[model samples]
Target: MVRLKWRYRKRLRKKYGRLIWKVKNRKGRKGFFKSTVHRYPRRNYRILVANEYIAAHLAKSLGLPVARVIQAHVRGPRGRIKRGLISMQAKGGQVIPWKKAKKKLLKKPHKYVKQAKKLARLVAFDAWILNPDRSDRNLILHKKKSGKKYKWYGIDHGISLFGNPTKWNLRRAKKKFSCKKAYKFCLHSGDKKKQRIPRGLKRFTRDNRKQLGKMVKKIQAMPKGKLKKAIRRVPKGLLTKAEKKFIQKVLLCRHKHLKKALKRVSKHFA
Candidate 1:
C-alpha cells in the first residue's frame, strides 16, 4: 500500500506539475512549462512542457537584459486558458515606455534595440543558435527608473531542437557574436545575408541573441544545484525531428565556434 501510494503521488505530480498555468486568489494567471515533442512515432507533446522550458531560460538571465519571462504555462485543448505564460504579463527588466515616448524620447526603443543586440551576441558566441523561436513573444522588455535600460531575458527554447532549427547559419551567428569574444572569427567568417528582417521578425531575432548570451553568462555563474533544479523541471518532450544526433552536431559546431569567438575577443573581455 505504501509503495502504491508513493507511485500514485508521483503520477499526480507529473500530470499537474507539467501544466503551465496557475491561479493565485481570483487572479487567473499563466505559468511557464519546460517541454519538447517527438516525431510521429513518439507522439506530439502537449504545450505544458514546451512553454515552461522557455520561461526558465528567460527568467535565468534578467540580470543583464532581455525581457524577463515572468510566467510560462502549458495546457492542451482540454486545459483551461487565461491569457498565456509568456504573453503580456511577463516581466524581468523594465522597458522604456515605447508607445509613450515622444520625439526627443525616441531613443528608448531604438536604444533598447542596440542593447538587445548586444545581448543576442552572447547567444551567438555561446552557440545557442536557435534563432526563429527566440522571438519577442518569449522575451520581455525592461526599463528601470534610473533610465538605464538593457535586455534581461530568454523565455523560450523548445523550438530550437526541432527540424531546420530556425533558418540559422554561421554568418548571421557571427554578426550576433560578441565582438570582444570573436573578433578574428568575424574577420574570417563570410558575409552572410542578414536573416530576412521583416518589420517585427528582425527585431525579435536581434533581441533574442542578446538575451541568450545574458542568460548563458548568468547560468555559468550560478550554483550547480540551482541550475540543475531549474533545468530538472524541464520535461523530456520530443524535439521536432527526433534526430538527437543532428541537434548534437549543431550544438557541437556552435561550441567550436564559441571557442574561436572567445579567442577573438580575448583582448576585450580578458
Candidate 2:
C-alpha cells in the first residue's frame, strides 16, 4: 500500500497561460470553470488540468462538438498552478437525463433516429480516448427556441484517458494496452450480463458503424506535431517529460487499434 506523490514546481514564476476571470457561480450558468484552485499537494489532482487540455484538442481535431477549453491560471491553497482548464460554459442547452431518456426512447424507437449520427461520432471520440466518464451529465442538449432542432455537445473530459485523478507517474496508468481494454465502451467494466453501458454510448447503434469509422479515421489523421504541441502546453510542474511521451504513445496506440476495438463495442448494439 504505497501512496503516489504529485510534484508541483511552486517556485517557478514563469506563467504558461493567460489569467481567467473568476465566475460567480457555475451551477446554472452555460459555461463552467474547472479549477484545482485550492487543492495543494496531498489531495490535488493536477493531472486533470492537463488531461482536459489534451482531450479538448483531440475532440476538436476530429470535428466533435465540445465546449471550448482554454489554459487558465488559478490561485489555490498551496500555490498558483498555471496549468488549468477552463471550459467555456455554453448557454441554452438542457442536460439530458440518461435513464429516463433511455427508457422513453426504447419504448418509442423512432425518437432515437434523429440523434443516431451525432451520437455515433461522439462514441467514436470517447472510444478513442478510453473515456469512462461520459455520463448523462456531460452531455448538453442545445435546443433551438425558434426551430425544432438541437445538438448535443460533449463536455467534462478531465476523467478521460487514463481515468479519474490520473496521478503523475502512476505505473497502473502506463499499463500495457490490450484489445480488451481498447474496445471497451466502459473502461472498468466488461460485457457481463449485469454491467451497464456508458450513458453516452447507448445511442451508438450498430447501424452507425460507418460514422464511427469515419470519426476514428479523422482522429488517426491528426498530425503528430499538433498532438505534441498540445501536450507541451500543459503546466510545467504537472507532468515530466517522460510522462508526456508516454501519454502520446498511449494515444497513438489507441488510434492504431481503434477500428478493431470499435467493432467489438458495436457488436453489443447488434
Candidate 3:
C-alpha cells in the first residue's frame, strides 16, 4: 500500500519501480545512482520483479515461510507512474540476519530442534528454484517475544528461476543447473580441524532427515497446474506469454529431476 519514488540525479525518470539510492562510486563520482534494494524495478526490471513475485507464491504453495509480495504503482522522478512490488515486512518478531543469529543458535542444537528441520527444507527449496544466492544475508531469523525459538525466512529471490535474471531465455533454461551452492548452508559435521560444521549445518541432526525427505516429497507432489496458476498470477506486461511458458517448462523439468539433483547435495545435510 506504499508508493515509492524513483530518484535520479535529483530528477525523477520512469524506468521500473525500485527504490533508488544515490551513492558515490569508489572513484568518487558524484550524482551516481545505485540500487541497494532488491527486487526494485529498473532497466529490464520487470524480469527481476516477476522473479520475486513468482518465487514468493511458489514458496507459499510449498508451505514455506516467505514474505508476501504484491505489485503496486509508484511514481518516478518526473511524476511518471509504473508498476513495482512491495514486500510486506514480517511482524510479531524482530528479524535478524542469519549471519548474526548463527553464532548463538549453532552452539546449542538441542534448543532449536524445530528450526533445524525448517532450515533443511529451506535448503531443498532453494535447490528446487535454482537460486544460487542463498547466502547468510539473504536468510533471516525472527525471534518471537513469546518464546525463545527463532523462525527462519527466505527473501530476495530476484536472481532465481532462470538463474541470470536479466539475460534469461528458453535456450538458457534448457541448460542443466547445479544445486551445490544451494545446499552450501545446509547443516553438516565439519572437518577434523574445525571440529564444527558450517553455520547452516550446525543444528542439523539425524532426526531431521526423515522430515527433510518429506519436504522433498511435498515439492515433487506439487501439481503442475498449480504451478502454472501461480505463474499466471503475475500481472501482464511484466512478462510475455512466451516468457511465462518458458518458466513453467523449466520449473516442471526441475521438479521432475529434483530428487536426483538433491541426492548430490545430500551429504551436506547428512
Candidate 4:
C-alpha cells in the first residue's frame, strides 16, 4: 500500500473514494482516511464533526479505551493541519475486520470469545455513559498475552455527540447479551444448559459501571468555575440549543449529579 497525495478537489471521492488508499504499517494495515465523506453536506456536518472530536477527547480524559485521532490535511490555512479538521490514518493494533468477525466468533468457539465479552462489557459502559453511536463493526478484536485474550478499542465517534438525537434511549439496546460471540461461547462450552454467563462479563460490566459513575462524580465534585472552564475547552459550535434540548430530553446534559448520576449509571448494570 502506498500513500496518496491529497488534492483539493471540488467534488467528493468516486465509487471507491479517491482519497481512500490502503496503508500498510508496522502493526496494522488499513485504508487511508477519506477526506471527502465528511466534506459532503449533510445533517449538521460541522456540529457532527466537532462532536466526534469532542467525544474522542472526552473519552480519553475519562480513561475509556478509544482510538488515537490523527489530524491530517491536504491543504489548510497557511498550509498546516487545518485547525478544526481531523482525518483517520492507519495505526498500530490488530483492528479486526468486521467482515470476518461474525464468522470467526460464531463458528464454534475459536478462542477469543471470552475476550470479546470482556471488550463488549467495557465498551457497553461507554455506550451507556455518552450513549454514543456505536455498532458491532467499530470494535476491534486483538490477541493478548497470558493465553490469547482480547481487547476492544472504540472507533468512529463522528456520529456520536451530534449524530441522531435518539442516542440517549437507554432501552434501545436490549439487555439480552447478544454479542456475535456470546452464542458461540454458550455453544462451545461444556455447559449446554441455557447460555452461560461468564464471571468476567459480570465483573467487567460492574467495573465499567463503577468507572463511569466515578468519572461523572469527579466532574460533579469539581468546583463550578473549574467545570465551566473545562467545558469551555470543548469546541464552541458543537454546543447547540437543539442538541442541548435533545440531551436534556435524554437526560445527558452537563450538570452536577454525584449520587444521581451514579445511580443512573448502575441502573443499566447488565
Candidate 5:
C-alpha cells in the first residue's frame, strides 16, 4: 500500500466518489486523483478498492494497457479513508468519441494492424475478467507528438468482478461464473437489437485470431503463485482470506473456457 498525501486544489465530486485535488510529487509535478470509498449494505467495496488495484497489476502483467493505479490515502467527507485508491490521470490524450473514431476505425478498422491485434487481447482480457464496462466511452486516444499515430488505453475496472463491487461474495466468486451478460452480443449472438461488439473490439479479428489465442492461452496458463501474488497487491485487511480464495477460483474457472468463448465471438468480426 502506497501513501499519497494530496495537496488540495478543487474537488470533482460524482455519485460514486470524489476526485482529489491535484497532487504534487517530490519534483512538484501535478496530476489528477481518483478515490474509491467503501459503501455500506446497498454497496460495499472496502475490498473492491483492493480488487481494482489487483486487476490493474494483472492487466499490466498480461501486456494490456491500463491507467496507472495505486492504493492511497485521501481525505473523504467522513474522514481520511485508508481504503482509497488513486489513478494517475493520463496526460495529453484526448478521448476519441466512438462515433468519430467509428468512421475511420470501422472503415479500415484494422488500419493500424498492430493496434487491431492488441484489441483482440484486450477483448479477451475483459471477457476473462467479466467486465461489462468496455464501452467506447472508456477508450482514450492519445497522440504522443505531432503527426504521430494514437495510442489507445483501456480504463476503469472498478466493477470487473461484479457489476456492483459489493455483489461479490464467496459463493459467487467460487462458483462457475458466466460471461453471458458481459460478453452477451460480442461473444454470443443473442439479440440483434441488443447485441453488439464493443467499439474498442470491433476490429478484434485482425491477425487471423493470433492475439486472441495468445491471450487466452496466457490467461489459462497463469500459475497459481503468480495469480496469488497479483491479488495480494491489495492493501492488508481490505480482502479476507476467504475473499481472496473466492477470486482465485473465479479467475481459474473463467480462464478454463476463455479461448473457445472468445473464438466464438471473433467469428462475428470475421
Candidate 6:
C-alpha cells in the first residue's frame, strides 16, 4: 500500500494517461503500481510482465485461482515507455498475507479444510511452472465478508519460467525441466526443533490422494494447442521468437514428467 511519489505519479500520468494510486513495495523487487482509473496496476520489466501474462493464462487453464493479467504500457526510466502487465485485484474480500492465513488454518483446521485443498493445487501448480519463489508472502488469502470462508490465490510469477527472466536459452530451460526435485511449500515455522507438518498440508491426507492425482491428470490432459494459444497471447516484442519456442518446449516437457514430480512430493501427505 505504498503511494507513488508525486513527481513519479505526474510523469506516469502525463505519459500513460492514467492515475496510479499505490504501488506494492516488495523488498529486492520492483513494485507493482495500482492504477486509479483502470485498477490494472503496472509491473516492472517487460520480461517479468510477459511472464505474469503467460503464467496467469496457464494457471487458469488448469483451474487455479489466479488473478487475470493483461499486457500494459508504462512509463519507464528517463521518460521511456515500456511493456508491462496489470493484474486485476480480487474484490469483495479482505486480502490477508499467507503468514497470517497459515496461523488461522493451523488454529482452526476444521473450519478451513477447503483452503487446504486449494493450497495442494497451488503447490502442484508451482511445480509445473518451475516457480521456486512461492514464499510465505507470495500466496494471497482472501477472507470473505462473512469471515467464515476463505479463498486462496497465488501471485508473483516474475521469475517462474526459465527460472531467470533474462536467460531463456534452451540450456537453462532443459536443465530446469530435467530437475526431479519437488517444489517445497514455505509453511515451516521458525523453530527448527518444533518443526512439523503445517496445517495447510495436514488436511490433505490419504483420502485426498485421488483428488491430488486428478489434478495431475488435468494438467497432463491439457492440450498442447491450448498452451500455444496462451503463449501466443503475450504481445509480440515482449517475448522473442526464440524465447517463446523455448518456453513452449519446456512446458510440454515438464507436463510429461509432472506426475512423477508431484508424486515425489505428495508422499508426505500420505
> Candidate 1: global Cα-lDDT?
0.35
Q: Rank the candidates by TM-score, best first.
A: 5, 3, 2, 6, 4, 1
Comparing candidate 1 with candidate 4, which one achieves the higher TM-score?
A: 4
- Clash counts per candidate, in order, are 41, 4, 6, 0, 0, 0
Top candidate, metric TM-score: 5
**Once superposed on the true structure, which residue ranges of model 4 sit more than 4 Å away at CA?**
1-44, 73-93, 97-132, 143-147, 164-270
TM-score, each model? 0.39, 0.67, 0.68, 0.47, 0.71, 0.67
lDDT of 4 by residue, 1-270 (tens): 323244333222332112332332333433333332333423344444444565565555545666655434444224432222333432444546333465545332225554343343343334323433354445545544453644555655544433332232223322322223221211111222221122233335564454445555544444545433324444566465444444333213333323343354345445
Tell me the TM-score of model 4.
Answer: 0.47
Candidate 5: stretches off by over 4 Å: 1-43, 73-83, 92-102, 109-116, 172-197, 206-208, 263-270
- What would the per-residue lDDT of candidate 3 be over residues 1-270, giving only the tens digit for each residue? 554432223432222233432222234332213222334235346666667878988988988887666554544456655454544445555666567775557665447534566666776677677665676656666767775777767766765664444455554443432323223221111111111223655246344666667778898799988888888777677787877877776666666676665665565553
Ranking by lDDT: 5, 3, 2, 6, 4, 1
User: Of 3 and 4, which scores higher on lDDT?
Assistant: 3
Candidate 3 yields a Cα-based lDDT of: 0.57
1-270: candidate 5 lDDT, tens digit per residue? 655565544565543442444454554444445554435622355655765777788888888877777655555444554334555655654445343574566545567423656766787787776565676655555554553455666666666653345444556443434544333322221112221356545544554467778888888778888889988887687777877776776676667767655655566664
Question: Residue by residue across 1-270, what tens digits does model 6's lDDT show?
Answer: 323322223222322223332222223222344232222333225456666778888988887888666544555446644344455456655776566765667555447644465556666677677665666655666777777767777766765664434433445444444324322221111111211233455354344566567777888889999989888878777677877887787677667777766665566553
Candidate 1, number of clashes: 41
Off by over 4 Å in 6: 1-44, 71-83, 107-110, 113-116, 166-199, 202-207, 267-270
Task: Please give the RMSD to the true structure for each candidate, in Å.
Answer: 11.7, 9.4, 9.5, 12.2, 5.6, 9.5
lDDT of 5 at 45: 50
- Report lDDT (CA) for all predictions: 0.35, 0.57, 0.57, 0.40, 0.59, 0.56
Which lDDT value does model 2 have at 20? 29
Candidate 3 Cα errors over 4 Å, as ranges: 1-43, 72-84, 107-110, 113-115, 171-198, 202-207, 267-270
Model 1 regions lying over 4 Å from their true place: 1-42, 46-118, 122-127, 144-151, 163-233, 236-250, 258-270
